[model samples]
Each structure stands twice: as structure tokens, then as C-alpha cells.
Target: MRRKLTLKDVSRESGLSTFTVSRALAGAEGVSKESREAVLRVAEEMGYVPNLAAQKLRGVASSTIAVITAGTSNAYYLDMMNGIQAVAQDMDQTVVLTDIAIGGVYDIGRERQTIQRLLEGRVGGVISTLTLLPESVKRLEDWEIPIVFVDSSPPEELPYVPSVTTDNYNASLLVGAHLQSHAFQDWLLLVYPPIWSSRKERERGLRDAAAKAGATIEVVEAGNNAASASKALRDCLGRRGGRLPDILIAGNNPILLGAFQVARERNTIIPDNMAMVCFDDFPFAPYLDPPVTVLNERSEEIGRLSAHMLTEIMSAQIEARKAGKPAAPIYTNEHQLQVPVDLVVRRSCGCPDPTRSRS
Candidate 1:
């Protein structure tokens, strides 16, 4: 194959230093607008690509952000990644996504090595949805790199690292209100024990809503995954005859899947037999025999907003460096962002029969 056109070629052809070419390509300052455009135009004509490894040797940031996720297999995370990629692409920035594998087995060592390598290499910043160990977070704090948390645990005291997430509490309350208005009497709020912060906030919303309406609510612990949720549902159903829950609220998509499995096995017809509402609106929710009712948590918007915050932090750091000021430390902000929860009224929650509902 012909040798790949390199950044050196662009510098030589444009009569600008390689540093100016790098900054112009990376959208960083220090190059005039005209010079930046000229460099880009020549680089495009020359088909020039920067050698990332060589760029690192020159002590330049890779203009890349690392996103560490719990797992890329999850639909929610996948959506989030798409949002992040969309924004990064618009800015002509590159991303490196590292999966923090399930069960924490593949995460610990990999994260440590990855962070060390990034510090030694060319990554500009990191945006993470993985729960960094306390010590690791502290180490990263000391490194002075711009780090933003995306839907993960936030430190109690720090007030700099920004995060964006749904208003889980309000969303749960919305679900609770939907069921209450539907005349659901006895309800079960089923969630996993090792709950994420988002789920915990949702549970609070559910409880608060139920309390307001005097709805009798019972809490059931369902382990993550469909099988465990199915088992938990069965156990709950086995308790009493007329005491069966009129509606079941599943905390997340996995739990909702389990609930569906139990409903199918028990030959339970939705709405007529029992009502159901899920937190994470699964893609197939609308196609079910009785389409699912849900509080549509906008995971993509959450990702986009979090990525925006990360971009803000990175820009600030760049500005600080240009001003010869020390970079700020990573810290969690108490600011809560509220993304509206959509109530997708569907057949599962007894789609209103217009004649009867109006009458």
C-alpha cells in the first residue's frame, strides 16, 4: 500500500509549523482563524492524517476523550454512547470507549492500567459511567485531568465534576400517579437490592406518590435479571388470593423483562388481570400483546447533556492552560438536571376506552 499521507506533509505544504497544524486540526487556539482554515484545506488536499503515537511523543493531547462504561451491551448505555459519539463527531473529536465488564472482574486492573497509560499517553480527558474505586478517583483527582461522571456514583463533598441524569424521583412519582388514577389498589414496588442511585431516587418518588394517594404499597426485592425477577414475582403472587397486587411497578428494564416472564408463565393477561409499568422503556414496549405503559427515561438526552458538561470542563481546562493557571480539581456538583419523564399511555395500563372514560 502507498504510505499514508502524514501531518508532516501538511505542515511542509502549508508552510506552517507542525504545532500550528496540530492545533488547527484539534480545534485548539494559538492558530489564527485564517491559518487554521488554510492548514485544514491543505491537509484535506494532501489526505494527511496525524500519527497518534507520534503526536503523543510531541507532548500533545490526542484530542480524544475516554468513556468508561459499565457495559456497552446494555441498550441504555448503547443509546448513551450514540449520543456521546454524535456530539464528539460534530466537534471532530475522537473517543475511546472502554468497557468496564460486568461483575467487576475485568474492571479493576484494566481501569488502573488504562488510567496510567492515558496519563502517560495523549488522552485529553475522561467521561465515565463506571464507578471508580475511591482510591482510584482520588488518584485521578490529583492528576488534574478534566473528568466528568455520567450516571455513576458522585462523591459526597466535591462540587466541580458535573453529571446529568433523569429526575428518577419525579419519574417514579409519575408512574405511581398513573397507577393510582387507573384504580390500582394494592401495588408492589419491586427493585433490586444493590440499587443504583438513579433507582434509589425513583423508589423514593414511588413511595412519595403512593403515600400522597393513600395507595397500599409493598416493597419486594428482585435480583437483577429476568429470572430472579420472575422468581420474585412468583413468590409475591404466592402470598395471598385477593391480596395479589393490582399493579406491579418494575424498577428497570431487566426487572421489567423478569416481570413479563412471570406474567407469561402464570397466564396473566395485562390490564385485565393486572397492570404493569416499567422504568427503562424497552424498545419493544409498544409491540407487546398489551403494549407496555412506561415513564420514558430519556437515556440519550442524559448522555448528550453529560457529554456537554464534559466538553465544558475540557474547554475550561484548555483555557486555564492558555492563561498559565493551574487546572481545577475534579469534584461532584450538587446541581440536579431535570429531564421530563414522558408517560407513554398504552394498553398495558388499561388504555382509556374513550366512551367509558369520558362517560
Candidate 2:
């Protein structure tokens, strides 16, 4: 039997994205006139028809959970995702992942579109890696879909919203203390933007730590990618009379990679020329030419905890609905969690360990 025409077929034939095709077929907004016309032309030529029954059935998606994140360029993203998937799989729930940013560039419009798509699909729960807009949170709440944030906090206006994340302020203090131990007087922090809420905490802690240590610290903002980090660092160096700081602090794995790229380009030896450390630990940290020191955020643990919290709330909502009661999710003090982090020391921060170290 021949396969029936679907969104994928329309997308392939129209040379447009599946998202664009979906909006075009539904006569929804966000589809340009040119794209909509092309999609309609292709659907007519292919004898396409909407599968209303299938869509109606798909709308009963109480067993599906969506995980939303900014981007997934670093290895730690996999670790956290594995933990989330483990819990979801054990609960017999399907998982869907959506990235609001590609190539480490955050887009508010993309985030808005993603939330709408999830709602339209009748997702039962959401796990976000970063804070979302207030209205987006409200829509999910109004629908009674449980949401749990991982590696980031909910917006300030919704303090009761559940989250699982490291104590970033303390984590930065930990990093700062270690840098002080090495007596590094000048530190350069090349960090990503504040869209990832943790940036604010991390920066605050670093600022306080620098003051306490009597060390000079400078921050250069960059997009959340290695290429952006490289450019930012290169420009920062140019601004500083081409003099390297005593130590460089990268906010995350991608930024760390960019810092390395700049150092190598300048023939700058690790620790000898400048010490370095980063926020998240990755697989290659131990195996790098000079093993990198990093703050261990325990991403897998965060992911598992986040998924468990969302599932708990969702289970409660289901029970409430079954009992013909209000089906809003439950939130308690336990739901607002702050997991502590540890700094893993290595040669990259001027430690004299020539061998691979444990994290």
C-alpha cells in the first residue's frame, strides 16, 4: 500500500521546514505568504489531506513530557539528558526535546513558538533548562501541565515554581577561592549571556570573591559558544594592551573550548602563561593536554532530580483529575532545591599534577 501524505512529505516536497509546513497546513500564523502558497501547491499536487482522526488521538498526550533547553553543544548536555530519559523511560512516558537556540544563540521568538507547539500537541509536562517568559509559564500553569526547571531557576515572579540547580553563587566563590590560593592577581572571566539565569548568580559570587581576595577581575560577555568566546577573548586581549591575565575563567564547556582556541593561537602555554578553569566538567577535561580544572555541576543528578520532580507533580495532577478535583500541580519547599557543587582541581589551574585526576 502506498503511504499517505503527511507533514514530512509536504515539507520534503515544498523545500520548507516541517515547522513552516505545519503552520501553513493549519493556516496558522508565522508562515509567510510565499511559503504558504508553495506548501499548498505541493499538497494539492500530492493529493494530501489532513488526518484529523490521527491528530485528535495525538492530542490525548498525557503520557508525553517535553524537555526544553537552550542548546546542546557541550558533552554535559548528554549526561543530564540521559538522567532525565532514565526516569521518564521507567515511568513509561515518552520524552520530547526542543532546543530554543541553535548554534548557542538564544531567540525569544523561537522560545515563544516552541511553547505554542508544545501546548498545541497537548504535552502533559515540561522540563526547561532555562527560565521562560512569564506568560509562557502562565499558559502552562493555566493548562495544569507540570513544569520543572533544571540547571536554571524559574523567573523571580514565580518563585514557587520547581527547579533543580547548583548553588551557583557558592560555586563561583569556590572557583574564586581556588584562584586566590594560586595568588593570581588578574583574572579574566569570559562568560555567556544572562539568559541562562545561573549567569547572574555566578557573576555575583565571582564579584564578591574577587573583592575578598583583593584580586582584579574583568568580565567579557559572549554568546554561548566557543566561536563567540574566541572572538570575545581576542577582543578583550586587544583592549588590555595584549597582556594576558594571570588566569582565565570560562563560564561553561563551549566557552572553555573557545578560550583554548585563543590560547593556542597565541602560543600561550597553560598555567605557565595563564591558569584556567571553567564552570561545567566534561569528559575531555581529564584527557586534555593540560587537564582542566572545573566546577562539577553534577548535571546527571540535576537532570534526574528535575525529571523526578516533574513526574511527581504530574502524578498528583492525574490523581486529582481522576478524583474529580482541581488538577493543578503540587509545589512545596522540597521542590525548590539547590544542589551544591565541588571544584575539581587539575593542572590547568596551575596545580602541579602531571597525571590525570579524578572528578
Candidate 3:
């Protein structure tokens, strides 16, 4: 069997002292930049994997960061994961992916078990895309395990939990303004319940803009899945007595896809029948029959910032422990980061075709 590389091997290969190699690999400040670079390069080349278990047992921070998602199926979450993995790789930290049902049914037992397992595995920190319950947050606090939320805000009861999220309110406002400019008066917003902070903020913004534009906005509670969205849309259309709204706004990619399916089944042509817009610029948005207009939430940036914030918090805690000081939660009012979203105009919202030129 091939032998695993160790820190001693890296030290020998780089011709550096074992202490220097150790400190450099641990990202300690005492090591010179030149020495650290050389050590890291040699360690990479030699495939030197640190013994994270040993580190954890020694009461030092483990080199693993846990990234929690609602599920693994969505392309939106996949994009965010890509950004998170990139930052984790650059920092020489390992990432562990975990899932907990956040927007779905609230299973307190399952969530508690998941948290306990992560703690048992000695994960140094967490970046959660789901809004954990207040009890769950307290469990993590008890363990002193720092967590940074991505794509979702912490529950209102746990305001101290730091989060990286998009300005969904502003994004929705942009969409509302665009619709009003195009003279779309009647609006139908298909969205999940307000349990999700992003959806809540978006609904608020859209409602505000609708009021100002003298447009009537009707909101339907569609769950955050394709099947649920399709059912909700079909039910709404069936009960509307053949009166379709001027525009349809889907809250997310899955909801958009569901609505699209129902529209196709009912032979409802986009834009020509009812103009459409949605949040989340998924990869296939441009390839649809009438390419969809969307608000790009910059999900990748949210992931990157969340991971970076957790790393910073962990580093501070580590430094404090080393200095023989008590470690406290690092996230405060200043830690809440809101990334901006971009409006990607496309044909679905009555925009000009991208492939055509105007006279």
C-alpha cells in the first residue's frame, strides 16, 4: 500500500525545521511569508494531509468546516457550494456537506441529532444555508461552535447569529419597476410561505412597489418545490374564472420551473399570454422558449462571504484561546452582510430578444 505523507516528510522535503513547518501549515503568524509559502508548496506536492482528529483531541481547532444546505438537488445551492469549496480549498480547510430540512417540516429531533453529530466530528465551524430554529442555535452556542448563515437569515429570535444574504427587497423592487414601466398592472406572485426570510423580504418589496404603481398584486402560497409550485399555480389559474394576471412572478428557480410546466400543459404562451419574471437566474433561463427574465441573487458571493466570515470568527476564537482568554461569540451587529442582486433582462418579461439588433 502507498504510505500517507506526514508533516515530518514535508519538513524534510522543504528543508525546514519541523516547528516551522508545523506553524506554517497551521497558518500561524510567526512563520515568515517566504517560509510559509515554501512549506505549503512542498506539503501540497507531497500530499501531506493534516491529522485533524489529532488536532481536535488536543483541544485545537479542527481543519474542517461544515456547509449545511436544505438539500443537494437544486442548482442554486450547487452554485453556492462551488464558491464555498473554492474558498475552503484556498484556506487549506476541508469542507463537509450536511443537509437539514429548514423550509420543509420542522423536525426538531432530526436537527438536534445532526448538530450533535457535527459536534462529535469536531467540525471547527459551520456555514448554513438554512435558518435553524432558536433551539438549534442555542445548541450550537452551548458547544461554542461558530456558524455563519448563507442565503438565509437566522430566526428573528436569534438575531445575534451572523448571516450573508442578498438584498431581495431591492431586487424585487427592481423587478416591480420594470414591470410598471412595461405597463404591467395586474401581478400574480407565486411564492413559498414567509418562513423563508428571502421570500418575505421580496414579497414586502413587491407589495410596496405594486402599491406605488397602482397595480393590483395577488399573492399565492406556493411551496418551494416544482411539484408544489405547479399545483398551486394550476389551482390559482383554475379558480380565477379565466382572468389571468398581466404578469407572473415566481419566487425562485423551482417555482419558475413548476409554473412553466403548468403554463405549457395549459397551452399558455409566455409574454404573449402572461408576461413572466422570476428570482434566481438558473443556467437554463436563457434557453427556454421565451428566455426568462430574472434577478441574479449572486448566490456564489453569498457562499464565499459566509465561509470567509466563519473562518474569521474561528481564527479570532483560536487566537483568544491561545492567549489564555475566554472565547466568546464573534458575530455582532456589524457581521450581517447583505450582497446586492443584479437584474438580468430577458424576453419573458417583454424585453427585446438578445439575439436581435434594433434599428
Model 1's alpha-carbon lDDT is 0.71
On a 0 to 1 TM-score scale, where does candidate 2 land against the true structure? 0.85
- Expressed as tens digits, the lDDT of each residue in 243-328 for candidate 3 is 77899999888788889898899788889899999987788888988999999988888788888888888889888878987666
Give one digit per residue, the lDDT tens place, for model 1 in 1-359: 23446678888999999889889987898899999999989975764544444555644463778887754534677778888888888877788887655531235777776665555454677877755655555555555556667665555554344666677777787788788787777788777654255657777888888888788888898765566778888888788653457888887677787888888887888878888888776677787777878777787887777767677677777787789887664344443455676988877778753223552
User: Where does candidate 3 stray beyond 4 Å?
Assistant: 1-61, 102-108
lDDT of 2 by residue, 1-359 (tens): 13445789989988999999988878899989999999989986875655433467774567889999887896778889999999999999999999997878999999988877776677889999989998889767766777988888898999999999899999999999998898989988999999999899899999999999999999999999999999999999999999999999999999999999999999999989998999999988998879999999999988899988988888888888799888878899999998888888989999977464667
RMSD of 1: 12.5
Candidate 1 vs 3: which has more TM-score: 3
Where does candidate 1 stray beyond 4 Å? Answer: 1-62, 71-73, 101-122, 239-243, 329-336, 353-359
Structural similarity to truth (TM-score) of each candidate: 0.72, 0.85, 0.80
Ranking by TM-score: 2, 3, 1
Estimate the lDDT of model 3: 0.82
Candidate 1 at residue 342, lDDT?
A: 90
Question: Highest TM-score: which candidate?
Answer: 2
**Model 1 compared with the native: what TM-score?**
0.72
User: What's the TM for model 3?
Assistant: 0.80
